[model samples]
Target chain A: MVLFPGSNCEHDVVAAIEGLGGTAELVWHGDRSLHGVDVVVLPGGFAHGDYLRPGAIARFSPVMAAVTDHAAAGGVVIGICNGFQVLAEAGLLPGALQKNRGLKFLCRTVELRVETARSALTTEVPVGTILHVPINHFEGNYTCSPETLAELRADERVVFRYVDNPNGSIDDIAGICSTGRNVVGLMPHPERACDELTGSADGRPLLRSLLTAGLATRPA
Target chain B: MKFPVLVEVKLREGIADPQGATIERALPALGFAGVEGVRVGKAIRFMVEAPDETAARALVTKLCERFLTNPVIEDADITVG
Candidate 1:
């Protein structure tokens, strides 16, 4: 896990990873280097005061240059909530995170409909399966030009959509992947939902998928 | 003469605005009472060097299309006076 300024959930995400036998590193937003971390995560919170757009100003942070470079080399990038917004702003991913249709800070667990099972991230999840993840964002709506949205749909780039459409995202998208699903930005907090019966445990499958992906890449 | 054009960019009806909320929370401390319904929007003020309002509107539209809003989530209204 990387800690950007204004990030309030790094510790929790780190704890979740730690509980899962993974070490999470806190990377400050000011640092320009990635420091040998295998996976880069942009945790949720308000960054650069969420100016212009939710993640607009933060896209220019010195650390992002390295992040973009790392992702270009097929490194995994996971952005949650505001982190997702930042990914879109950085153009590492297409589309934009718009304000939620209700115009309120919605905080609750919602069901996410898994749209694809091909990505390394979603290899553990079956397509069309419903998983519960807590979403606490006002700018969780995903939007792109109709042509782009259509193309994404045609290309299987859309990995998930909120089953309930909590936010008025284009085509009700809640999660998306890059061309190869190597990089994913999700508005829901999988870290917050990794435990079943805890209301957040529904997120464990996604995290579990990360480990599964790492294992798949290990030397045979 | 400088004409002040209002370029209000409000979150599309239901967009979440944490920045606006943070500012609103501080307004009471700043003695801004009766400031109800304070939804923060972006107002960009730029002087257009066009020959006339029609040309200005066209340029602004292009700017809006290419840069201002994503066209999928936001709608920009360009008015020249």
Candidate 2:
């Protein structure tokens, strides 16, 4: 996973991945190569200090260009919170993140409904299964056009929907899959809510769910 | 080279745009009700051709995702002519 300079959640995400017995390496955002890594995770945090928009500046980082190339090559990219913002800014995903509708910084643990079990991840859960995850952000709303929304629905790319919807999201969307489904960006902090010590283990499956899918896209 | 491009952006809706409505209401008070459809919006302009359509679409979408619009509170669309 690439760590942006201001990423507050990198260590936490590392701990969560480590605690889950998953191997994770933190690569600085400026690194130019994936170093043979099969998947790249963009951990949540205030990249470029969240200046001029949550991740507008971070999208242009030296590492983002490499990340974009990797994602285009079918490498898996998972972004959470500010990471999601960076992905949107880098055009890895669709939509943008903005200040909350109420214009307040929101911090809470919320429930999310699994929209598809067939996705690269979340295949272990049944559709509609709920999981608890934490979210912290001023701009985490998921917005997209009605036409794009329709295309996503028709393509079944909606991966997760917030059950509690801590923030206002179009169609209650909490997570989405890329056109290839291997790339996913979600607002909820699954890494932060992945432990029993965190008082909830609901975020556990998301990390491990796709471990068996074979990292990266299968040979064509 | 003057060419057509599609720019997508979003502004707050009636309930969400306090800035826009403030401007609208103040217009009437300032004797500018002539601007009844006073709503705030964003403009994105670019250039493209048939061969450039796919690249243009992708690039414009990237621009929308990156800068031209915010994905959460704001919505976006593209026009090509």
Candidate 3:
């Protein structure tokens, strides 16, 4: 896991992953290497105080160089919420996360339908499976050029779609994967919903799927 | 030399800006009529340690495009002095 200065969700993600029998550690943004980690997670938060824009400054962090290298090698990278913005700014993902359509900071649980089972993040999730996850953001509305949207669809990059269209994202896109299916970015916080005590356990399957993916790539 | 630069980023035309519209709607009720085409944007001011104005402008434009603004949904207006 990568921890940008303002990141508050690293521990949450760590706990979730650890609870699922996965060893996770935080890699500071100032660091310039992944140290041979298989999965790099960019947890959600107001990185670099969200100055200029969300993920704008964090995208230039030294660790990102290693992240790009890792992803290019087909390593799995998951960016959640503000992490998603970082991925977009880093050019690892297409489209931009602009202000929500209603211009309000939305914090609520939303239904997300698994769109593609091809990506590492959704491989264990059956297509059309609905997961109730919580999203908290002011700039979570995803927008892209028409051509990019067409490409995303044609390439099977979209992985999740909102069931009720909470933030007015184009095509109700809630999450998407990279062309290689190794990188996934989403607005919802799966970590927050991983336990039943938190009101929902829909996130379990997603995290388990990631764990399954990681195990597959584990060196023999 | 140090040059001052201003970069304004606004949502491209045809993109809905509910924040601007909400403010515009509030203006009419506050007796400020005839307000139309309200759009919200971000203004960024910074100083660049470039050798010349042209260099500063070029640097600032690059910054605007690469980081200060997301060209996918925004248009940037940059000025250097």
**DockQ in order:** 0.22, 0.23, 0.83
Which of 1 and 2 is ahead in TM-score?
1
By summed lDDT, the worst window of 10 consecutive residues in model 2 chain A runs over: A210-219
Q: List the residue pairs that clash in candidate 2.
A: A96-B71, A98-A139
Error of 2 at A72 (Å): 1.7
Clashes of each: 7, 2, 0
**Winning model by DockQ:** 3
Off by over 4 Å in 2: A214-220, B1-81
Q: What C-alpha lDDT, on a 0 to 100 scale, does residue A215 get in candidate 2? A: 49
Q: Between 1 and 2, whose DockQ is larger?
A: 2
How much does each candidate deviate from the true structure in C-alpha RMSD? 6.8, 6.6, 1.4
Full-model lDDT, candidate 1: 0.78
lDDT of each: 0.78, 0.76, 0.91
Candidate 3, A29-72: lDDT as tens digits: 99998877778899998999999889989999999999998888
Q: For residue B31, give model 1's deviation from the true position in Å.
A: 27
**Per-residue CA lDDT of candidate 3, range B1-81, in tens?**
999888889989988898898999899789999999999998888889999999999888888888888788888998888
Lowest-lDDT window of 10 residues in candidate 2 chain B? Answer: B12-21
lDDT of 3 at A21: 92
List where candidate 3 sits over 4 angstroms from the true fold. A218-220
Candidate 1 structure quality by residue, lDDT tens digits, A148-180 = 888889989888888888778878898889986
